[model samples]
Target: MENGVKKQDQLTPPPVPRVAVVLFVLKGKSVLLGRRRSSVGDSTFALPGGHLEFGESFEECAARELKEETGLDIGKREYLTVTNNVFVEAPKPSHYVTIFLRGVLVDPDQVPQNLEPEKCYGWDWYDWDDLPNPLFWPLEKMVRSGFSPFPTE
Candidate 1:
C-alpha cells in the first residue's frame, strides 16, 4: 500500500526437507572420508551422504547413500544427531536435516565404488585426532561437539 497500490497476500512456501548421512568407520580411533568428485559442492573431503528419498527411513537412506557413494556396505546404524541449517550448494535453498550414523566396513580391503563419477573421486581413512582442516562445515561441528566421527559407545 506504499505507492497507492493495493497489496495482495502472498502465500509463503513450506521449507524443503533434506536428509544427509554422516558415516564413521571405526578402526582404533580412525574414520573414513571421501574426496568428493569435482561436481558435487566443493569436491573437497567429506563424509558419505546424499538427499533422502520420499518414504525412505533416515537409517535406510544413510545406508543406501553410504553404499552408493562409497561402495561400502554398513551393517548397522546408530543415531547421533540432527542438524537444521541452510544448505547453500544444494539444488535448492532449503532446510537440511543431517542424520548421523555409525557404521563399520563389511570388508576392509574392498575399495569404494564411486557410482556417481561427478560427485566423488575417491575415499580414504583418517585418524580422529588428526582430522584434516577445512572439513565440510557440518562435519567439523560434529567433531567439535566431542562426538566421535566414528562413535564407539
Candidate 2:
C-alpha cells in the first residue's frame, strides 16, 4: 500500500510483443551482414534490420532499415520467411517475430557503410557456408532450419 491506498501487482498489464524487419541483401553468392554491438545481441553477426515502425509495411521497414543501417538502396524485395525469436538470455528478455526479406542492391557498385557505428561495425559479405562466428539468435535459427536466403543465381 502506498499513499494510503492499496496496490496490486496483478493489475499491471503485460508488455506487448515486438516485431522486427530483417532484410538479406543478396548479390550473387554473398549476403550482407553486420556485426552487432548493441545490448540485445552484442558481438553477433546479424542482418540489417530494425524494430518495425507503427503503420509501416514490411517492405517499407526493410527499405528504411537498409538505408538507415547500410546506406544502400534496395531494388525489389522478395518476401522470405518469418522467425519467432524469444531471447530469454537477452538483456531485456524480449520477444520478437522477425520478418525476413531478400533483395538485391539497386546499384551494383554501391558499397555498404557503417551508418550506425554505435550499433553495428559496418557491413560485410559472407557466404552461406562460411558465416562469422556467434550469429544473432534469429539468424542462427533461420540457418539451422536450412533456410537459404540465396537459392538461385
Candidate 3:
C-alpha cells in the first residue's frame, strides 16, 4: 500500500504464449502471402496460417490453415524453424511461438483463392527477396534474423 491506495492481488494471471503455425508456400522463388484482416496483426502482410488447435499436430495446422484461408491444398509440409514473436507494438499485446513450415501444394497449377475474406484481403505470390512493406511480427523477425525459408542451392 502506497499513500492511501491499496492494491489487491491480481486475479488474472499472465496469458500463456500461443502457438501459431505459419507456412512458406512457394512457387519457384516466390512465396504466398496475404494481408491480414483481423486483430493483432491486422492489415499487415502475413502468410496463410493460424493458431495451432488443441490435439492438432503442426503439419495438420499447416494444412488446415492454408486450406481454410486460401483454398489451397497442400501435399506435405516439413518443419522449417520456429520464431518467438511478441507483438509489443500491437494495440493489444500478444505473445506467440510461430512455427515455420515449407509446404508443397498438391497441384502446382491450382491457384490460391481468398476463401476467408474476413480474415485476409487476398492471396498472391511475392518474391521472397522483395517482399512488401510492413510485414507481420513473426515474418519481420525472421527476416531480421537472416533466416530464409528457401533451401540453398
Best by lDDT: 2
Model number with the top TM-score: 2
C-alpha local distance difference test of each model: 0.71, 0.89, 0.87
lDDT of 2 at 136: 89
- Tell me how far the alpha carbon of residue 94 in candidate 3 is from the true structure, in angstroms, after superposition: 1.1
Which of the predicted structures, 1 or 3, would earn the higher TM-score when compared with the native? 3
TM-score of 2: 0.89
- What shift in Å separates residue 40 of candidate 3 from its native position after superposition? 1.9
Q: Give the clash total for candidate 3.
A: 0
The digit string of per-residue lDDT tens for model 2 on 1-153 reads: 777655664566555679999999998788999999988889899999999999999999999999999899999998988878787787777889889999999998899999999999879999879888899878987889888988555
Instruction: Tell me the lDDT of model 2 at 29.
Output: 80
Residue 69 displacement (Å), model 2: 0.7
How many clashes does each candidate structure show, in the order listed?
A: 2, 0, 0
- lDDT for residue 32 in candidate 2, whole number 0-100: 94
Please list the residue runs of candidate 1 whose C-alpha ends up more than 4 Å from where it truly belongs after superposition.
Answer: 1-15, 37-41, 88-92, 150-153
Task: List pairs with backbone clashes in candidate 1.
Answer: 37-119, 37-120
